[model samples]
Target: MLRHLIARFVFLLAAICAPVLATPAMAATDVSTPWTDEDFASLRLISAQTQTGSSDTLRLGLEFELQPEWKIYWRSAGDAGFPPQLDWTGSQNVGDANILWPAPHRFSIFGLETFGYKNHVILPIDVAIPDRTQSVAINLDVDYLVCSDICIPAAATFALDIPANGNPDTSTSGASTVSTHAHEIEKFVSKVPLTGDNLPIQVSNVFATKDGDATQLHLSVDGLSNAGVTVDDILVESPLRIGFGAPVAVNKDGESNNRHFTVPVFGLNADQDLASETVTVTVIAGPLAIEQSRTVANGPTDASAQGEPLGADTMAPATGAGANIWLIGLFALFGGLILNVMPCVLPVLSIKVMSAINARDGEISRVRSGFLASAAGIITSFWLIAAVLIAIKLAGGSIGWGIQFQQPLFLTVMTIILALFALNMWGLFEINGSDNLGTAANDVINQQEKGGRHLSSHFMTGMFATLLATPCSAPFLGTAVGFALAGSSFDIIWIFTLLGVGLATPYLAIALQPRLAHALPKPGRWMSVVKAVLGLALVGTAIWLLSILAVQIGLGGAIAVGVGLVLGAVFVWARKRSQNLRPRFVFTALAVTGFLVALFAPGFSKPPAPSSVSTAATGPLDWQTFAPETIPALIADGKTVFVDVTAEWCVSCQVNKKLVLETAELAEFFANDDIILMQADWTRPDPEIADYLASYGRYGIPFNAVFGPNAPKGVLLSELLSRDAVLDAIKDARSTAGLASN
Candidate 1:
């Protein structure tokens, strides 16, 4: 019995030791295939004999040892070359496999750029095991392209097997199995780009502009300067079929702590629009690198353009030429006086006329008080605008006239305000002192004379008038605003103050000579007819605002908002018609609710689908959507280009388009095959269009520029367009093109 027990124990021990002795031999046997072309690179598959922790997942690596001067492509191969691909269809017990890519270097060949690794690279592969009890076998068929003077395609098949239960340390028998390459794996693992939540570097602003046939992108990197790092190069990756050139550093006058880089983008498909596309920019500084993605806009925002002000250098030429500051002020004054006749301001000006008419029979002192208050309000509003422009300039941002119209929130709020004003004018409800001049004068005469609210009401009317005048750029107003915005903070304040004084001159004159009001007819039923007519004008303005909103939100959303306004107006009328206070209060509450619904309904809807008319077809004379690169290409092809930078909010732009550019004669002249007409609609905020406008040292709209072979830089037109001016510009451009050709 003793002998039998000893023999049984020995048999059990041998059975366990037998597998352990053979495990080393399995681990030592190479599972990697020989390199097909060792002169370029050597490929292999490596894995660990023992699994780490309690996880059923195994870590493997696709290792490549590249020879000197040979390289492999990254996931985004800048201008050319294909990234490495792996096929694992011939594997077993592998649930999924993912290859991790490391940060790559930018290689510039001639003018073309590429991103890849030049030295030995190891792509760590994570293999998932569905059943840990069963052994895992991985068979990888790799296809990769290596390049030097030329690119060469290479392929190889690698097989790796992991044992279910293997002791890595004690495996002495050289069995064919997995072994640890943890040191090599960990070295390259650190090279992989950091992801998931915390990133070291941040990209603050990215702006793109058209540079001839290429796109110039400016990237502002934050914290790079504080860290004492220099950006060696940058790589831009886009889904569109475009190519990128090498990145160059941009130096600004007063900004040193911030790093700015400009990279040239090439090969943009003329048939596609870049407004909705996104680009990923990777900045590689010494010992540090960061990758960020941003949507491609026309140009950078005020925050992005802070370090570099728009038209700063261009304005230098004007200042150096001894431009008269007083002359500019006089021009601003004339522009402000003429602003009263502009279509956009005419509706609001009707309120001022009503004030004068209502004050005809009132006390002379009261008339003087109301007109003076209105003048004060205009000047104060202008000062406020000046303050905002100065503040933006101090912060290193670009400032343009009527930039508030670029904001969708501003547009939406203004629309609602105009609608409510129209409703009040139509007698749906009456604000205490806002109904008309007669009501306001009565409130002033009957209420506390010292603390009357009518003065503030009249003042607000003046402010509102100034606000309405912003979207229309008058002749002298454009030049004055451009010069003021481009000048120092003090200059901005001074010029704007003059502009306000000019706008308020009419009211001030009436206030000084109270007899002006005495000449007007007395307040009677006729005044009601005049008020109704002005109310209709306000309603027309409201409708135009809705049309602008339709471009951003959608036609459906705009219609919903219009319906809500009508419903709210109905409830307001019900409130006024109610016989009892309780019924009236209930109707008022319902009206408020309806108004709230209308105000927010557009936020819930998706943006409208872009019109097919803008994207359908292309012809030389067919008005193509404005793109920066389009101008240079057209000029290069020996064609004359006419660019119209207009917006729906710009009343002046509409008038010019209808009366001059779209006329039969003008259209026929532009119909020539060698003439290209491009329209850059600025109904919404477009940074690229802003930048293009800045390049000409002009900020106001209804801007036209003609580019031909001779005037390759471009010849700018005035804020107001005329038939003669358009024809003369076209003729000059053609003459210049002919001269250049000769």
Candidate 2:
């Protein structure tokens, strides 16, 4: 912000005083300084007049010509980056100086937008000269940022001396020869936008549609009626999560040359809704641009951070934060059911099968109760997770699915619990209803062993299944979760509960029809073999978690934790069969002590292991590191970009890579030079990547999108990608011009 620059200018003087980049371009004129020689861009100072003469004002410009695909920010750089600042502290005979910013073009990539200038631009300035009779010396110290693939901070010193007016300066130039930048100065000076009433654009009317289920802005502009404007032709800037989307013409009046555009409001939350703040709106039409500001009328609203996909068709229609909960609920249910087959859920399925087998010999009523308890547990677990997410959302923190796996402490805890479960299945130690520690839950429900199994045991199984299911986003899960997370707390609860119910559908059906339990084969010696196999599956899960823990706290910590679990299992096995005096006390203490390393060894400070995406691995195709800001400029140059947002921890992402993205056919197609491939690694916590995901209303991985000259908003793929889906999306993105809807 300009205010930030002003507040910290004094502290930043040392850095600002550093010399500019050497090797400048040849001086354009005696009134102009040489351009700084930088690979990405070059800058110079140009004066329109060689002498101050009788004129009270001296005109100059800071001219910059950027290399291909490079850009600099406007006065208000959207999303990220800052504008250039000039310090004239070492100047003589200058009373004041003012910078006039040229109109900036909006860069649209993925779902976010930024404003800047590409190619060449000049920022015109006017100086107030109190004494035109005296020689005026101008020294400009400029600090600015330029970005292409990376952002580089640049500084330059430019000096231009204006000769004193003796004969009132002959024609304001010596020997009737004007400065070389005279024409360029006039060209950019005309490009500066007019302010206030001088601006051609007018906000004819501003109104908000606030209802129980909706909060939106309906704007009517006087000059742009039926001007054929798309969402790309406008830019919105606000310091809040919720914002107005691109203007869509709802009604047009050719007779009056007016357009009533309905703007979809996105990401509105409980705290900030753009209600009391000013929103800067910029409209771009060919070479003409105009900016205006309108303060939203404050009102009571139920808007939450959730918003429908922006630039959908025309209206981008949506109602309130809880829009289309019924559809979202159904999607969640189906997504949850599909989680039953995910790779991460395989171990839990074994545990589930063992429990089912043990209950097969029990009475039908007892079997039904156990299944019902498990189903209840799944729903209760979802509620617990939803509660935490809601709390984080309310407190303004980042929240995402499977994000818990990013924590070392959580990984350590999961590893120990899985190991213990494996030992129990291996018969290292037997747990009775008296031995159960579910006291808090036992009070509400009878946990006493009825038919050799307690309800608490079954309930815990369901809860664990839900936890494991999070790593791989099941089919339809991303949509349902994105919708849920983007909306109110109620939406999250509703969707997640439906997801739990969907996942527990099989259990619920068995509970409803107790006869299913009676139909299982009678318990036999084969059950023991099945238990061993199930135990192995759980042990494998523990191992996988250990590998991830190794990345978090180093291999040594993981080995120590693994050793502790093994020793703990050894003591547990001995406690069951040992004949020594005080064997129970000794074995129990030893087992508990073995598990202690896991509690204190893992550290959360270390980042997760780098994934293929993070490393930007060399493949058949030329893959670029994810840089969202550069996407639009690439598209402007008529190139297609395919972006894959993935993480190593995401099973679905690996599946997509093997089955769709890395396939021979798609690989060959992407290998084409025109097709730009960018991969983002989300293995570690990255605020930029998180914000990008949130922009699209997604909270999970295996995300894919295609951007091209035709598709400005890009084509969003599903969590699970298919060959046909990938081809169709890429083709559509490349061939179709401005396909606004997914």
TM-score list, all predictions: 0.54, 0.56
Clashes of each: 13, 3
Top candidate by TM-score: 2
| Alpha-carbon lDDT of model 1 | 0.69
User: What TM-score number comes out for model 1?
Assistant: 0.54
lDDT of each: 0.69, 0.70
Root-mean-square deviation of every model = 26.2, 20.5
- Candidate 2 has an lDDT of 0.70
For residues 123-163, write the lDDT of model 2, one tens digit per residue.
Answer: 98999998888888988899999987789999999888888
TM-score between candidate 2 and the true structure? 0.56
The Cα error of candidate 2 at residue 139, in Å, is 29
Q: Per-residue CA lDDT of candidate 1, range 41-108, in tens?
A: 98887774344223457777778889889999999887789988989887888888777776677676
What clash pairs does model 2 have? 213-320, 268-304, 306-486
Question: Candidate 2 — worst ten consecutive residues by lDDT sum?
Answer: 18-27
